[model samples]
Target: MRLGSVIKVKPEKLEEYKRLHRNVWPDVLKTIKACHISNYSIYYKDGFLFSYYEYKGNDYHQDMAKMAADPKTKKWWAVTDPCQSPIETRNEGEWWAAMEEVFHLD
Candidate 1:
């Protein structure tokens, strides 16, 4: 499976981000699924957000580009984008930092 990661910060206000994600927009959900992504998850630590997604196709970069071009994805990003910060240490075009997998218990 292909893997990807993203980062977002804890909102300055109370429970705003959590609430928004609790019912993510249907169009946004559809856009992600259309991109051939599945088994998605997000985690938080030390006030940093980490997202993981698995892809099941050969054309990852092209699919990601399509996802970015989607209007729904753009709208979703407009809302959730403010909650994120790019990792300062990553190379350019890296919005999320990649995590090195150390172990897999499962």
Candidate 2:
């Protein structure tokens, strides 16, 4: 599985952001599971929200398309997406900026 990261602004609408994640509407969770993503998590520091996820499926694009097709995910994005701003230099058609994994020692 490959690792990925994306960035977004700390929500100015703090309460709403917190509320949505605190509950994470059931369908959203279902969508995640259906996509074959696991150990997903998000963190915030220095006014930036960082998301980390692992993809286990054979085709990431197809899996994500499944995610995008979900009505619940679409609704969830409508509410949460406004809280983020993509990095200026991030490539087009990409939501979160990606990080390079230079070395792994295990």
Question: For model 1, how does the per-residue alpha-carbon lDDT over 10-104 read when each residue is reduced to its tens digit?
Answer: 55832666777889999988889998999888777776777777888779889889999999889888887777777777667777877766555
Candidate 1 off by > 4 Å? 2-14
For model 2, residues 27-104, the per-residue Cα lDDT tens digits are 999999899999898877766767777788988889999999999999999998887888776787878888777776
Which run of 10 residues does model 1 get worst, by summed lDDT? 5-14
**Candidate with maximal TM-score:** 2
Residue 28, candidate 2: Cα error in Å is: 0.8
In model 1, how large is the Cα lDDT of residue 98?
Answer: 74
RMSD (Cα, Å) of candidate 2? 1.6
